[model samples]
Target chain A: MELFALSDVPEVREGDDLAAIVEDRVDLRADDVLCVASTVVSKADGRTVNLDDVTAGDRARAIAERLEAITGEAKDPRFAQVVLEESNDLVMEAPFILSETRFGHITVNAGIDRSNVPEADLLLLPEDPTGSAERLHEELGVPVVVTDTCGRPFRHGQRGVAIGWAGMPASRDWRGETDRDGRELGVTVESVVDELAAASNLLAGEGDGGTPFVVVREFDFGDHGGSDNLFREYDDDLIRQALQAWEFPG
Target chain B: MELFALSDVPEVREGDDLAAIVEDRVDLRADDVLCVASTVVSKADGRTVNLDDVTAGDRARAIAERLEAITGEAKDPRFAQVVLEESNDLVMEAPFILSETRFGHITVNAGIDRSNVPEADLLLLPEDPTGSAERLHEELGVPVVVTDTCGRPFRHGQRGVAIGWAGMPASRDWRGETDRDGRELGVTVESVVDELAAASNLLAGEGDGGTPFVVVREFDFGDHGGSDNLFREYDDDLIRQALQAWEFPG
Candidate 1:
């Protein structure tokens, strides 16, 4: 499979048609799978926020003060408030906020962006990333994977992950499958959408020279069982469960 | 960037020259990045083990008994012994085995495989994946990323990750970079090797049809600064610290 970024994508604005923008920039193939940065999706969906307009709640202010005391850096309560407003739950409330968004993705700061916004002070991840992807997929008639960059546990730095996807299953299920020796496979679920997002994110780095829209061509999902159960529920996630009873020493 | 899996990789044997195997299969290009799955690398390095050869000690047996009690599944003390022998630290001990391997990768069971071995009963990850990649990089005159599929804290399914990389930096440091509006970029370090491995993993799924090696062509690392730090140290990882202070409620 081949991947290329869409060049010269103008600064996105609220109410802009992402599908039309992509369709105008390139003649997309039927087999193409488009990976979109959530920045543009948020832009089109009016997900940007101005801190001046945000009111910091008691919780946000307390969290910000605690963060400031712990990290020795200036903390913005309005930003914390925005994260709180966008989140369903705060998985980690101190040192840094690890949260679950309304759309069920667990990420830092509710996947909020302090940068990458031209028209607003902050750009929130799409209100519903999977819904955003579905809209694009419906308009473009191809698979759409909405991508984001986030830090993960047990590893340094960050890479791309799929917050939402459409027109394709989120993962390829390898259960009951066998390896070359016909032994049962160890890896049961392969998150193909996340892999696609990571691949596109490699081509679309963050910066002035960044490319937000990437086209992945000729990828075959194969004749394997597919699954859309990409996000784990509260009872199923061990880390989330562990975090519930544990507190940061700070 | 284009990615394609190398076909017809025969069952890897111990003492195999991996570079020679790739060279014989395809005429590789200098610009291509080769992603070799850990299974093949382990096999080539004689990292397989026989269950009969292992002796479960007191610790392994006790741990296995606890796990079986908690999960209500038949647990093997010998398997737990293998995992203990392979691990430097156990981040999670109950309900499951989460460990830090000798080479610093934090994964379940120190990434030992009970499947994917043709001759042995178990397959262990390479002793030093970076060293394995370095040797291949030296022989082939191109980048090599040793890939592994792993589960993370929040996400549901597993995706590809880089356990070891050579001939290129692990991450593209975007420090001091600016967005389109000339604002300092929010994302600083982009883990390019992990992204590359994730891309290759999309094409090389686990099964009888699995392709252990994939070639990624024309992936540009750009003009950004590079860093070789992929795994997190203890002080730098917050989740590790959290895991330290908590125990499984089970």
Candidate 2:
């Protein structure tokens, strides 16, 4: 597998043609998989917010006040309001607001970006990343994975993860597959899109110097059963349940 | 960057010189990264166990009984004993044994493998994965990452992660880096090693036909501040604390 980023992708604006940009840049092969950063996707989708435009409600103000007091730093209620509006649930409250976006991706502040946007004060993640990928997949004629970088629990630093994907299954199921000795494999499924996203991150760095689009070539999925269920729901996720019942010992 | 697996790697035996095996197969480059699966590393290091030889104590037996009841399947006390001995702390006791290995990696069953081992009943993770990587790094003159595939919370499937790495820092520190707007970035760090591991897994499949060694070529670490910390300690991880205080509620 080889990954290379598209060079000199101009700043994306609202209603920009992503497929046309890629088509004009290079000839994409049938075997190639495209990994696009969510920041550009959101920017193109006009998912920007001005903190001044948001009106903080009672709950947002209350959360901001508590956050400010806990950290001994100023907190913006308007920012908290934007997070609340974008999220379906909040995973953590005090030190930082770990939120579950309306689309079910859990991350800090619902994955709202504070920097790298030249046009807006905040850049929200693409409303439906999978849908965005599908539109690109239809135009590009290849698999597309929408990538985001976020910190995960029990690990330091952020790496790329697939928030949305199209034209491919999220995982390669190895549940009943036999190992070298013909014994059943312990690893039931391998999440491929997320792995592809992480691989793309090796070429696509962060910030002003970052590349928003990456092309992965010669990555064959081979013969394997496929599954598309990536995100875990309430019952499927135990950590989320644990967090729901426990309180931070502030 | 490109990745290709070394074809026809013979089944690794105890005391096998992995660096020699790779040196024989292909020429090593200064910019190449060798990602070796921990299963092969453990096998080469004789980190295997026989279930018949293990004596399950009261703690292991009690833990096994609870697991058997919850899972409604016959559970082996000897297997539980192995997990207990390999782990430094038990993060979850019921439903499954989520353990923090002595090396600080948190995974189910301390990352023991029941499949893929031709000589033993079980294959434990490398006693010191970093040391193992360092040994390979010293001989090959290239960065080496000892990898393991495991399931994580909030995600439905497994992906590759670096349990041990040598000759390079685990993360690219973007702490004080500025974004396009010259505003300090919110993302403090980017975990590059884990991303490398995940990328390598695209070629390293999970079963009998799986390729254990993947070579990543032309990958650049670039000019960035680096940090070696990968695993999250107790205080640094809020989810770990929550799990320590909460139970499965079964």
Candidate 3:
């Protein structure tokens, strides 16, 4: 499939007519999938907080407090946990960078960023990634994905993942099918959109002039439902609990 | 890219030439990437233990004793440390599936299996996935990935991940570039092969008729080196220590 990173667009902000902006930059066909980085969308909409005035330690403390409120549980003062909770959840934490938050979402800084924002503020994830995705789908007549970078438990680096999806099938199930030899197939449900998001992120670098949104064409959707039919309402409490218990390197 | 699963080539047993079997069934070419389920490979090579006669508790105890030797650390049977240890580190642990392993590998039952084996035996992962990759690559003139099914921390179900790789680039880095608007790119490195493995696993299910291997022909590799170049000698102790101190859910 030919994947193209959407370019020549202004920075995305909150409440901005994303569909209008994308339409202006690229030709949005009926089946096209628009994958967006959540950071730009969050920044444009003013979903950020400044931390320059506060000490890093104090900033961490504030994040821990917010986490406690969200999770209804106390967290230790480890700088990583504080940063992680603020971002969403820690995907991977190490000396160089902490990959967390954005949950299954994929982007640089886990879609948490200090760059391209006011000097003192840290941008957070969009309030509702699935909602953002749905809006984009409505505007462009194509599937939409709110993406952020995520770290795999055993792997060393990060890759893009879909946080919220609309207008596309999140997963493609291939069970009970037949191979070339006509044998009954087993369990193979492909996360088609997620892999495409990761592939697009390769061109959308974290800090470069890479486009935050990518337009993927020349792909197959098969018989799966569009994004609207594929959206799932995840339990936030369960997600938070899973994050707290995720295994990461010491 | 379109993905097709290659399955049902007979139960691999000891003395079977795995590479030959794969090449005969699948149209493996020089540029293709083969994703092989590790279970079949393990079973073919006789890395299994039977436990049908023992209770689940006894089975856990027996597994724990073996793991104690491998980990060189005391384990608590009451807490399922052996299962956790087998996962290298626990990324996801629920009632039915446990995702953990030394190489950050994620798999159901910690890459352990009971089906398709003599009622008495349980399968383990291949001893050296990279080596398997290399051997397959040499024979097939394409990249090979040894993968197993793994569950995620919060997400339900399982995804296939690369446990060992050869002939392909495990990751592709897109750093120090400019976007369409000319902003400097920072930390975006795509773990392309792993994501592909995950996507391919959707069709390479863990049931009756699924092919143990998948052949992907059209991935963009760019200027990256082969998987052989990506292999690094890691300190086993560091990995063990990281697992011990890693935050895991009970």
Find the candidate with the highest DockQ and give its number: 2
Flag regions of model 1 displaced more than 4 Å: none
How well does model 3 score by local distance difference test? 0.58
Task: List residue ranges in candidate 3 displaced over 4 A.
Answer: A1-17, A20-33, A43-110, A114-123, A168-196, A202-250, B1-31, B43-49, B52-59, B62-108, B114-121, B173-189, B205-212, B223-250
lDDT tens per residue, model 3, A101-161:
4434422344555444533246677767888788778877888878766654435666676
What are the per-residue Cα lDDT tens digits for candidate 1 across A133-223?
A: 9999999999999999988888878899999999999999999888888889889999999999999999989877658999999999988
For each candidate in the order shown, give its overall lDDT on alpha carbons.
Answer: 0.91, 0.91, 0.58
The CAPRI quality class of candidate 2 comes to high
Across A1-250, the per-residue lDDT of candidate 2 in tens digits comes to 8899999899899999989988998899999999999999998899999988999999999999999988899999999999999999888776789888988888889999987788989999999999999999999999999999898888899999999999999999988779998889999899999999999988888867768899999899988999999988988898888887878777
Clashing pairs in 2: none
- After superposition on all C-alphas, the RMSD of every candidate to the true structure, in Å, is 0.9, 0.9, 8.2
Model 2 local distance difference test score? 0.91
